[model samples]
Structures are given as C-alpha cells and as structure tokens.
Target chain A: MKRIVQILDSYSYGDGMGNHAGALLNALKARGVDTQIYAKYVDPRLSHMGKNVAEYVPSQEDVILYHLGAGSELNRKVTEYPGRLIINYHNITPPEFFADYNPALEANCRAGYEDVKFLADKVEMAISVSAYNSSELARMGYTCPLHQAPIVMDFSDYTKAPDAATVEKYSDGVSNIVFVGRICPNKKHEDLMLDFYYYTKYFNPNSRLILVGNYRGFEGYYLKLKKYAKKLGLTNVVFTGHIKFSQILAYYHTADLFLCESEHEGFCIPLVEAMHFGVPIVAYDSSAIGETLGTGGVLLREKNPRLTASVMDQILRDESLRKTILEQQKENLKRFDSKAVADRYMEFLLGD
Target chain B: MNYETYAPVLEKAKAALAKKNIPETAVSFCDVRMPAWMGKAFWFVSGVKRKMKRRLGK
Candidate 1:
C-alpha cells in the first residue's frame, strides 16, 4: 500500500482547514492509500506544530504532505527530509497586507514563500485551495505543477426544518447580519462594522450586526472596532466570541444578509456556508470572494464602507431581489459540497 | 505498531515540551541523540526556541 503523511502546524477537526484536511485523508484512505495526519496540534483552535515534532521523522515508505508554510519547525523538517513533499497552499498573504506592512513580516512571509517555492519545485505535485492562490504562487515564480482544491462544506443539515424559533432569538425582531471568521485585521471586521453602523443608521435602524470569532489575538484591532461602534452609537451590535460549529448554521439561517469584506482569503468557507443556507451575501470583490460568490451574491465595489453599506441597504430593502438571490444560492451551492471537493482532491493526489 | 501512527504522537509530545517555560540550559540537557524516534524529539524542542524568537520580532 502507498503510505502518505500530512504535516500541519495545527489540526482542529471543527475548523474549515481541518475539515478539509480530514476529508482529504479519508478520501485517500478509501482509495487504498495508507494515510495519516502528522501535526503538532490536534484541537479546535491554534496550529498543531509543537505536539508532534519529537517523533515525526519520515520513513522511506512515506510521502509527506505539508499544509501551510508558517511554522519554522515544519520548514526545518522539509529541508532535512528526503521524501516526496506535497504542499497544500492555503492562505499565504503577501507581507504588504499586514498591519504596518512591516519589513520583518514581509521578510518572514517572503522566506516562507521561498521555502514553499523550493518545496513546490522538488515535490511530486502541489495543490492550492483556490485559483487565486495558484496565481499568487505563479506570480512568486513557483513553476511547479499546480491544481485548485476548493474547500468542502457538507450541507445535509440545511435541508432539515428551519429552526425558526432559534433563528428569531438571534435575529431580535430586526434584520440579522452576521460576519464570521476571526476578528482580525485581515478579515476586515472593523470595516464591516463601520459599514454596518451606517447601514443601520440610514437604512434600517432595527438591524443588528453580529461579529463572531476569537478576540484574544486581535485585542488592539477589536478594541478599536468596539470604540468605533460606540462612537457611532451602534450599541445594538453583538460580538459573539467563538461559537460551536453546530450553532453556526443557526446564525447563518437566522441572518437576513451575510457580509464578508475581507482583504484576503484562500477560499472563504463562511461564504460557502452562507450560500448553503441560502443567505444573500454582500462581499468585497477581492481574492476568492468573487470566485466563490460567482453570480449568486452582490459584489461591493472596493472595500469602501459607504459602498458596502449602500449594497447592504439595497439587498435588505428589496424582497423580490432577496428571494431571487436565495433561489440562486440554492443552485450555486452544490458545486462546493464535501463529496465533490474530496473527489477532485483524490483525483489530483492519485491520478497519474 | 506501524511507524505512521507513532510518528505523529511523538512529534506532538516534542512540540508540547517546547512550549513549556523551562530554562534553555536545562532543556538542552535532555538527551537528543537517541535513535530516529528520540532524535526527532530533540530536534523539535531545540528548533522551537529559535522559531519563537523569530516570531517575536527578536
């Protein structure tokens, strides 16, 4: 049997990346390949690097698969190992997108890109999560064989009865708008809040904005956002810090509109989740948002708060347009299910 | 037991050790020159300090 090992800094089964990795591993195993995930950590949060480093040397029979290029320990192993290396490029943000765009972060990300580029050259093959990321690798001069492996979402739960009571509880008799993912600078929660503040003021005063994710890592940015919301008199906004995956769908179902103004993404999994729930999305046309949203959702011009708010207002006010989007979302969402994504990934990994 | 199952568990243990607040000199005293299994652990702990320092903007 062919042996395959996946290397990651962290592996949370509840996370989008973790689910993607887990599904791929299962698919590989189903094809009669002996596959195991070798990571530093295996929880719902944080990267899984430190946990597995002590005993993870590759054997002659193993093909090592590296996920994400952020950790030095993994980098060192890749440099020392002489096995077949296959890297799955998730989200590799250019240094210029960082807070201060500091030279240090730039240099570090550049070094990461160099390591990934080197591994890409030596590896049997490389797979990116989106075409946007593949183009990013190509621009950085990585000439290895590349293919897109979109993230997967299992939407069987959405077909169940709509928990109207649970949805109404979160909705609070107003239009519920939700923004998922980490409350970090890159996710652009602050920009979304600013737009949301204005969106409620002029368009619908009863609408509530919900920001969900961990706040510990981005305290400074999170504080700034809270202060901005206070200054704008948008106290009705809710900040839900880290929710369970099962509860996430309730929020998606309850939400009248979903907004993603992120500056970068490998593949916005939340957008896919929202689409699966038939929620209309108004996202900035950048990175993988355009590719994921396709023609089913509204695309905002730039990341301007006014433009985003304007688009949100338009979506909320029009009932016919909202119904049309929901109908289209139901149709477009089939392309991102886990089985389809897993099949594509298996074909890439096993097909000659 | 196949090496695949044991490899990840061993690596995770090394990574956990690296995150501890132990002194560098004391950490260095640990044997890092065992067979492939133990050698992997030592390399992980020794390199973690360097990795943390770099991420700290040091």
Candidate 2:
C-alpha cells in the first residue's frame, strides 16, 4: 500500500498556502487516500491537522509532495527522501522587493531560489498553482513532468455567515473599496492608496479604502505605508491588520469594489473571493492577475491612478455595467468549483 | 466586455486628471537593519531548536 504525504515548512492558520494545504489534505482523505500533513512549524490551533516534520518517517512506497515557497532547512531534507518526490511550487517573491523592508526574508527568498533550482533535478514531478508558476518552473529548468492546478479550496467556506456585528458596523451605506492581501512591498499598497486618493478627491467623498492583511514580518513596510498615507493627507483609509475570519467575511460582504494593483501573484485568491461575494473587481493586468480574473472584472493595462479611479467610479455609478461585471464574475468563478479542482489535483498527484 | 470598452471612462479620467492636482505617489522605506551579531545569535538559537526537536522525537 502506498501513502501520500504533503510536507511544508509551516502549516499556518488562514493564509493562502495554509488554507490550500489544509483543503488539499481533506480532499485527499475524502477520496480514501492515506494522506497526512507534516510541517516544521504547526500553528498551535491547528496542531491536530499535522505533525512535525522531524517525526515524519520515510517509507519506500511513500510519495512525498513538498510545498516549496521559501527557503527553509526542510527544503534540503526533502531532497534526501528515497521515494517518489513532487515539488509543489508556489511562486516565491523576488528578493529585490524585500531588500529594504525585511533583511531576513530577503535573505530567505534569495536562498529560496538557490534551493528551488537545486531541487529541479531531484524531483520526479513538479506542480504549480498557476501557469505563471509553471512557466517560472520551466525557466528554472524543472524538466520533469509539470502540471498546473488552482490551489485546492473549499469555496463553500465563504458561504458561512459573516460576523453580524462586523457586517452591521461597516455597512453604514458608505461606499467601501477593499483590497485583501499581505502588507508586502510586492502588493503595491501605495498604488491602492493613490487610487483611493484620486477617487475621494475627485469622485466621491463618502468612500473609504479598507486594507485588510497581516503585517507582522514586514512591520517596517507597514509603518512606511501608514506614514505615506498621512503624508498624502488621506482620510478614511482603514488598515485592519489581521482580523478574524468572520471579520474578513464581513469586510468582503460590505465591499462595493475589490481593487488590486499587485505586480506579482502566484494566483490572487482574493479576486475569486470578491467574485464569490459579487463585488466587482478592478485589477491591474500583471503576472497571474489576468489569468485568475478571467474576464471577471475590469483589467487595466497600466497603473494609472486617475484612470483606475474613473473606472472604479463608472462601475459604481453605472448599475448596468456593474451588473454585467458581476454576471461575468459568477460565470468565471465556476472554473474553481471545489470538486473539479480536487479531481484535477488528484490526477496530478496520483498519476504516473 | 473587452478592455477597449472602458476607453470612454479612461478619457473621462484623463480629462479629470488635467483639472486636479496630483500628489507624488512614490514611497520610501526606513533603513532598518539588524546587527550581524544579533542575526548570528538568532540563527544559532533556531539551529538549537531544530536539534532539540529532533532529539526529543517530535
């Protein structure tokens, strides 16, 4: 009998990678596959979900699927396993983005490339979350079989009722423009702030921009953004730094527009969430944004704050246009139907 | 709808841009670096933790 094990550095609580890993674990188990999660740092709350990698005993028939995103000692250990090994490559951010913001992560990401490139020849198969990441793997010389699948997610979780208090507090009828992502340099938070500035200065004064994400490792960058917002003399810009899942649900529930200006994304999951909530999206066309959006929202060819603000305004004021975008988003979202994605992942995971 | 359909909206935005004052949007970060000794100490502690975990069979 063979077993499949998913290995990662950290199995966190609610971040994109953690959620995808957790969902993939359950999806595999549901299909009666003997699957387990092994990680270096397991969140205390999710300790039952996985065990420490130090205790992961290797078997000759075991298929090890290593999730590679950052530089970690675990990345080196997985290469020594004498069995079928797969590299599930989640794109790593370029180290240049973090040179000034975080020295530790910058070093980790720099070494991460070396780690990834070193494993290129060791793995029997490589899988990525998007075509963008697949192309990146190819560029890095991953010649083994390569497959692309959206991160496994149970979208039904989004249907859970948002916190009532949160929804009520933020649903004061004022327009709310929202962007949900980690407060990292690559996310281009300043660009979102500028669009909000132009929108408020010219179009609607009753609007507020909500940025919801954790800024623990990148405190310097977070502080700089706050200082920059003050320098712009911007008002009504809310930074909800790492809130509860229900509160995130509430924010998405109250959002009138989902705007993203991220320069790089393995696959922007928030775009799909915004579509799930029927919030029209306006994102810059870059990296995997276009592929993930799939005609679901308005894609800007360039990062022009004034133009983005106008497009946002038009989508907000023109009821017909907003309806059309929402309809397209609903159709586009079907591509991520949980069962379809899970089956696709199974084919890749269980294939020859 | 294709991106070109938003051309009129872009034109409107361009017209509006000509009338309003735009702020400089470039951002700069604070120069924050940890001393080499502290970094080495942190790495030493992490390596110890990994060794301890392995020894404890966890």
Candidate 3:
C-alpha cells in the first residue's frame, strides 16, 4: 500500500482546513492508500494521532504532503526526508493586508516564498487551493509543476433543519443577513456590519445582521468593530462569536441573504455552503469570491457600504431574483462538490 | 549592498524597531553596526559587572 503523510501547523476542531483534510484522507484511503496526518497541533475530535516532527522519527516509506505556513521549521525537514514532497499553498497574504503593513508578516511570507521556490526546485510537485493562489506562487517566482485543486466541503451533515428556531432567532419577522469566517480586518467584518446597518436603515428596517466566527490575532480590530456597530446604533446586529460546524449549517439555512466582503481568500468554502442551503449571496468582487460565486451571486464592483447596501436592497426587494440566483447557485455549486474536487485532486496527485 | 538581497530584510528590521519605539539610528548604531572592539569591550564590562554583583549578592 502507498503510504502518505500529510503535515500541517494546526488542525482546530471542525475548521475548514481540518474538514478538507479529513475528507481527502478518507478519499485516499478508499483508493487503498495508507494515509497518516502529522501536525504541530491536531483537533482532539479527529481520530488521526498527532506527532510532533521535532520529537518523532518519520518512517522511510512515508510520502510527505506539507501545507507550508508562514515560518514553518518543517521546511528544513522536507529536504532531509527521502520522499516525494507535495506542498499545498493555502493563502499567501500579500504585504498590503496588514494594518500597518507588518514587516513580520512580510518576512514570513517571503520565507514561505523561498520554501515554495526550494520545493519547486527540488520536490516532486506543488498544489494550490485556487487559481489566485497559484498565480501568487508564480508571482513569487516559483515555476514548479503547479496544479489548482480547490478545497472541498462535505455537505452530508448539513441537511436543512426541520425547526424554524434559527430563522425566528435571527430574522424575527425581518430579513436576516449572515456573514461567516474569521473576524479579521481582511475578512472585512466591520465593513459588512456597516453595510448591513445602512442596508437595514435605508432599505429594510426589519433586517438583521449576524456575524459568526472567532477573532484570531484581530481582537483589537474586532473590539473596534463592535464599537463602530454600537456607534451606529445597530441594535439589530448580532455577533454570534465562534460556533461549531453543526450550528453553522443552522445559520446558513435560516439566513435570508449571505454576505462576504473578504479582501482575500484561497477558496471561499462558506460561499459554497451558503449555496448548498439555497441561500442567495452578495459579495465583493475580489479574489476567489468572484470565481466561486460566478453567476450564482451578486458582486459589488466597489467597496462602498452604500453600494453594497443598494445591492442587498435589490436582492431583498425582489423575491423572484433571489429564487433565480439560488437556483443558479444550486447548479453552479455542483462543480465544487467533494466528489468532483476529490477526483481532480487524486488525478493531480497521481499524475493521471 | 544590493537592494534586492538586503533591502527587504533591512526594511523589515527597521519596521520592527520602529514598532518597539527604538530610534532607527540608535538601533542601527548599537544593534546592526557596532565596531568589534566596542562590542567586545561592552560585553566584557557587562559580564564583569554581572559577576561582581552576583558575588556580592547585591
């Protein structure tokens, strides 16, 4: 049996990356490949045993699959290991994303760039999560054998709930707009909140906005956002904080409209989830959002909250339009289904 | 120094120092570019002072 070892920095319980890794491992196993996952930290919920590479010895038969993060020491070991190295570049943030254009982030990104260059020069192959990310690798001067295999989501556990509790909780006889993902500056949670507030005020007073996900390395920014919401007198805006995978589906199912204003993304998984639940989306026309949304969701050409509000207003005011978008989304989402993505990934991995 | 090779690191170091509120000139003088003799003398004096303080327990 072919042995594969996948390495990552951290695998939080029920995160997008963790879920994708789990599904990919299962698919590989189904193909009769023996797979083991190694990470600095693994979610306790996952069955795969975690091993700290610094303390553990890797077996000779193992093929190393690495997700190269910012300043990973594992880059050194990849050269030492006598196996095929496949690096999956998730999202390499450009220097502009930082608040003050943090140099540390830039240095780390440069290190990642060098690692990719080294891997491209020496390793077997490299994979990126999106065409945008692949282009980023090219920009970094990596001319390796690159393939675009976007992350896959498993919707088996995301069946629509029977109860209307989520709808009543968020909507309350109003339009409920939901935004999911980490509460960071790049995710633009504050912009979405401001737009939602204006959207509710000028367009639909009964509308409510729900923001989900945890604040990671952006607590001060999140606090500032909360203050901004309060300053705007947004009583209808609700911050659900961090939620579990099951709870996420509940929100997605109940939301009248899903909004994403992320300035960067490798592949927007929540956008796919929203479509799976037949939720119409309004998102910024940037990064992989436009690629993923295609014709299924409305895109804002500019980053103005009033313009975003106007777009949301249009979606809310027109029922037939919303239904049409949702129907198109259902069809558009099939291209990103786990089976199709998995097949493409395997084909790329095995070079078929 | 070639800007392509050294510019990025120097720029990053400058930014890091600025974040800490240390004067760029002072950091460059003390941290990045100090004469070998001056660095050795400073280290030797500091080492001797640390030893004396520890011995005296003061």
Best by lDDT: 2
Task: List A-chain TM-scores for all predictions.
Answer: 0.87, 0.98, 0.90
Candidate number of the best TM-score: 2
lDDT of 2: 0.86
TM-score of chain B of each: 0.33, 0.49, 0.42
After superposition, the stretches of candidate 3 with alpha carbons farther than 4 Å from their true spots are A49-61, A99-114, A160-168, B1-58
Instruction: Give fnat, all candidates.
Output: 0.00, 0.21, 0.00
Clashing pairs in 2: none
lDDT measured at residue A273 in model 3 versus the true structure, 0 to 100: 84
By DockQ, rank the candidates, best first.
2, 3, 1
| Model 2 lDDT per residue over A219-265, tens place | 66676677777877787999998688989999999999999999989
TM-score, every prediction: 0.76, 0.89, 0.79
Ranking by lDDT: 2, 3, 1
Candidate maximizing DockQ: 2
Would candidate 3 be rated incorrect, acceptable, medium or high by CAPRI criteria?
Answer: incorrect
Docking class of 1: incorrect
